[model samples]
Target: PFRFSALTRSCVVIPCTFQYEEDIPLTRGIWSKKTGGIVFHNGQSNVIDHFKGRTKILGDLNEGNCSLEIDDIKPFDNGPFCFHAEKGHDKYRFNNSCVFIVMKSPEKPVMTPVPAEVDAGSTITVSCSVAHTCPSHPPVFSWSVPDLSSEISHTLTSPGIWETKSTITFMVAAGDGVRSLTCTAIFWRDKQQAGTVKLNVK
Candidate 1:
């Protein structure tokens, strides 16, 4: 059994399969979310309130398609989930997991002085970035500057799949006040939605 992580407001198709010495009297397949010390599962044709209407079993059970489909993902749902099957008086279990991280549209990007503290008129580079969601959808960067009026300046870059550093840079006055900065990332075949990181400069 295996699970995959999905970003907030995204979708993922988890692959599932099972193996055994002989065909047993398989009764039911259960998918549960591990939250705190509790387990949320679909049993007796009912789903736990927390996961109700959010979890769906995709594919055919008779065909052993225990895969699950979760949509409109949220950070809270990120976890190490357990998938189990029952056969007569015996049971088999597998741990399948994926972590979902939430990043919404940024209103402004954060600006930090290179040294964390600086004097007026000092040369400082303000940076911005977005969180990684999945392999298919990589993060991008953008910025909002006061001098541009209503226009936003964007510096887009390829996904750093192998590198840990992903950031955009800007040189600004140390005395600048109330500046808005933003980091944005877009994806999906439709290219409809994105995540943002916003900051307010003081």
Candidate 2:
């Protein structure tokens, strides 16, 4: 059982893995909720209204990945959802494979390890990223560096994991020696978190 928490009005990706006894080709993927009620299938029909067009299998079915994505999270969308698959002539429903979705609160972003030494007059770029569910309102990154230029980007780094990163490249100065480099993640609804690391200029 796996779970993901998405922010309201955001999106959540629920990763799922499946197995079979035979080597037949996987032909279809299905998602059901609350006692076998199909919430998602190919096309629009047979899917519940609330989930129509908003839910789909993000993973490749042929690869035995039935991961699901639900966009624009609503309060009623909280679910302990399940996945099913059709492999050639054999069919199976993974009633035991359930993934839950929870609404999340903002958390601090983390930066990759930076080198301990930076040379004066040399340009360096530092990247910071955070996992978030909401792509529409991704967390924004801010730097404590004065008058520095930075680049911000978003990417789905893994199943159920979306990342927003901020990168800054700056010419190091002797005055920057032994200074703190801080990165902050500003999330939806005024939620914020930050992390800092020491930067040593040689």
Candidate 3:
């Protein structure tokens, strides 16, 4: 089983691999939904209209790669899909080998600096935040600064939505003229989004 998470209106790649007992001449490949509705077909003649121009095979079939790419993903695209392969007079359906796609909204992180301008030897706090609906799979936060002291917290902003905030505290030094702090938010399935803020030391 495979799982993929992607932002709405974005593209996602569903990786697939298969092996057979004996080497046989490859014929075609097909991806279908749980209801046996064809999402994609190698011949392109029987492809469902909903996925006609939005889906494509990413890997070469001759090399036994049947990965698929879906563009402009929508909420309706979420669900389980399986792959089917065909060889000379032999057909194989991988009902067990399925992929589930989850769709989410893309939220860019926001960086806010307390005391926008800091003096040398003074401490300042920079906060990076993002709002997401998946509380069960909260986003992981990371700062670009190594060995930086930080604190993380989360709040329930609205129904099914959560706001995560990471604050980094640091004292400005003469050597730290102008520095940039980058915050990366990683969601489930390795979906990563980031934002940055530049600190001005006066």
Candidate 4:
């Protein structure tokens, strides 16, 4: 995985992949800081105030997906997070397989075909997309064009980058000459970011 860039008050999924020869069917997951301190473990979780009950294993350990999910991320939760897995008689810690979190501010959504051009009585497709670090809880997308239905898809384009896109097909009618096409990315906790573009119908 890569050093993940995240937004404050958002969530992040630290992709923890490792190889082990444990034959056991179950494994215990652990998350620690780069400085060798246990932040979370399946045995017993005794973490800082900011991390208590905010972290969990989002992947199946037996399937070799030890990805960790952290919710309601704060500045105090920033770190180079590491993972460790252990089964009955086998154990291995990911010393180098760690991910760092980079806190970032919010940004507006991107609308393709800037100054969206449309045909008054023809069919057209337009899309709006945005990037976020949290895949477990993806950002919700909404469009301003009420008559057009949107199809959204999510992709993990990179190690720590997740993109949310909304594709809309419109059957242009005899509407006004120009109007606003607004798109909004709605996050958890009622946080939202919007981008609007005024377009003319030919």
Best TM-score goes to which candidate?
4
Q: Summarize candidate 2's per-residue lDDT along 1-202 as a digit string, tens digits.
A: 5767777666676878776656666778888885657777885798988888888787777676777778767876777787878756666877457777878766678887778888777777888998887665688777887536788888998667788988888777666559788888887555688999988887
Candidates sorted by lDDT, best first: 2, 4, 3, 1
lDDT of each: 0.45, 0.77, 0.74, 0.76
Which candidate number maximizes lDDT?
Answer: 2
- Please give the lDDT score for candidate 4: 0.76
Clashes of each: 7, 0, 0, 0
Check candidate 1 and list the clashing pairs.
Answer: 106-196, 108-181, 108-198, 108-199, 109-181, 109-182, 109-199
| Candidate 3 or 1, higher lDDT | 3
Model 1: C-alpha RMSD to truth? 10.5
User: So what's the TM-score on candidate 2?
Assistant: 0.66
TM-score of each: 0.43, 0.66, 0.57, 0.83
lDDT for 165 in candidate 1 is 23
The superposed Cα distance between candidate 1 and the true structure at residue 31, in angstroms, equals 1.0
Q: Please give, for residues 1-202, the per-residue lDDT of candidate 4 as tens digits.
A: 3577777788878777766656767558778887766767775545755577778888788877788888888876667787877666666776567777888776578988743567777776778888887887788888776645668899998876799898887776777688777889887545689988877877
What is the TM-score ranking, best to worst?
Answer: 4, 2, 3, 1
User: Which 10-residue span in candidate 1 carries the lowest summed lDDT?
Assistant: 156-165
lDDT of 1 by residue, 1-202 (tens): 2334355655444556655445554676666655432222446245655566666666555566676655555566655556676676677765443223334432222333345334444344444433332333343333443222222233323321111123443445465454434433343222332233333334
lDDT of 2 at 176: 51
lDDT at 76 for candidate 3? 83
> If both were scored by lDDT, which would come out higher, candidate 2 or candidate 4?
2
